[model samples]
Target: MTAATTAAPVGHDTAPTGHDLAEVGRSPATLRTFLHGLPGVDQVGADQRAAMLATRSIKTTAKAWAIDLAIRMVDLTTLEGADTPGKVRALGAKARRPDPTDAGCPPVAAVCVYPAMVPVAAEALAGSGVHLASVATAFPAGQAPLDVKLADTRAAVAAGADEIDMVISRGAFLAGRYHEVYDEIVAVKQTCGDAHLKVILETGELASYDNVRRASWLAMLAGADFIKTSTGKVPVAATLPVTLIMLEAVRDFHAVTGRRIGVKPAGGIRTTKDAIRYLVLVNETAGDGWLTPDLFRFGASSLLNDLLMQRAKLATGAYSGPDYVTLD
Candidate 1:
């Protein structure tokens, strides 16, 4: 949990340990065999682990630290059809100065928006120190052709996005076209250039924990800087069990390849308590190394104000309401 003032350069390699060099240039069949061979997940054990971690409590000093850390790790996202330049600008201002009354409060990690809104978001966040991220590759659906998806990714990068959150072709993955999903991520990574790439698995649609584990490996093996849980548009977004699986994948991925990949649990996480629970999961499961904003993030919008209100309570010894904070 470094200070929010620390600079977060896009595509910065946080883990220098290194990955399996041999796995880097393998054929599609070889890679698939390697990923599938990686042990299967025991759903019951994973669920118990997640449930047990969620009950860990924090209070007083630890509570305050978790609140601030959660604030700094937020993506502060706003992805909707009605998004406007004014809305994006307002969101950026909020990200830079989350609490107008309390300058000590840390700003959010980044601002996430649709590809069409990248220019507006980039301009709004120009000198704010908060990075701009765009969702490309047809976003929530990811049903477009490879060329269209690549073009969509390039457009976001050209518009000054520091991070690109691309959705994997779930249809291909489910259809056993693992190579197609892997190649798409590889191509998108090249298109990203200096920008960091986050591959979203959309776990709910994937159907099983085994598929989730396999998808996690597929994205990381193909060079995804971050492996995310969902797009927030699906029936089920980020859940404790699903997130736990991704965290385990990253931990094991680092153990096998010695490379560190970030994990983001987006959507449905709107409360300060829920955010802290996820922090506990990260601390216990992935170890404290992933506790920083760079290696972990919450892709959420409403969660920001809740955290601010909790921070205010810690300082003033009183609870606040929506009227006390901006509605962005």
Candidate 2:
């Protein structure tokens, strides 16, 4: 089916009522109980569902449309110690014009960078429709003290980050210190001010599917605009099953809260086929609203190039090598 194919709309199954909201005040005990009470994730069922979704087939035209949509949803990123101003500018330029030869190519959703490079990215992406998202809060580890994490978040927002991707404290969460994790997220959300917050759960380190589900609920409860799967630093980054669990979390979170939260699967996803498969998962699981960049994003850099090559092939009926697209 084409990306434009319409699907039957579904309403919230368990939208949080006023009583539920009031019951889940900032109290850690209440929050912990609520999160722990979330429906347990059946790993076998979830893995089966993700595997089934990945096997979906799309025609050429539909795949093309999905490719463009995937490109638009990409958070074109560069988060390396070697990241320099010149490299950031080049990345911004590529994000703005992913396929310079084709005017039909759409700009990516945003340019993700380290907090210190936000100014460089801002300057490079100026006038482009791309947003600036920075990774902060002792990213990848989330091991630092609460004060330090908040300061990191505030500095990134001050540097002009439209979105802050904060990593949750896996150490605390694994230690069963759910309250500590929830409170840290709440504090960081406040520091974000107008900027959006995307909380990374680092699912790989979370151990089981159950912890991922609980962490998802905890992040959403603490006021994350988007719930992400990983920090891209761990050995096992984003995976289909992990991402599917996160998507289900957002879908369920919206049901009770009447709030729309985004889901981002970062790290390992690197092909048009993989991205389209994810879009299919979103379409079937979260409904239509989450299909947009506002509610969904792919945290990727190399994924863009493969998409460009595929788009070029579709346009010219010829294989365009890596040389055709800008390398960032």
Clashes of each: 1, 3
Q: Across residues 1-328, which tens digit of lDDT does each residue of candidate 2 receive? A: 4333332222123334547766674677887777666667777878887898889878788888889999999999888999999999899888898877778789999999999999999999888879999999988788798899999999988888989999998988999888888888889999999999999999989999989888988888788999999888889999988887787777767776688999999999898888999999888777777889999999998999999988888888999865887776
What C-alpha lDDT values do all the predictions have? 0.87, 0.86
- Rate residue 234 of model 1 by lDDT: 89
In model 1, the worst 10-residue window by lDDT is 3-12
lDDT of each residue in 20-123, candidate 1, tens digit only: 43654367676667666666777787788779878888898889999999999999898989999999999999999999988899999999999999999988
- The candidate scoring highest on lDDT is 1
lDDT of 1 at 168: 96
Question: For candidate 1, what's the RMSD?
Answer: 5.8
TM value for model 1: 0.93
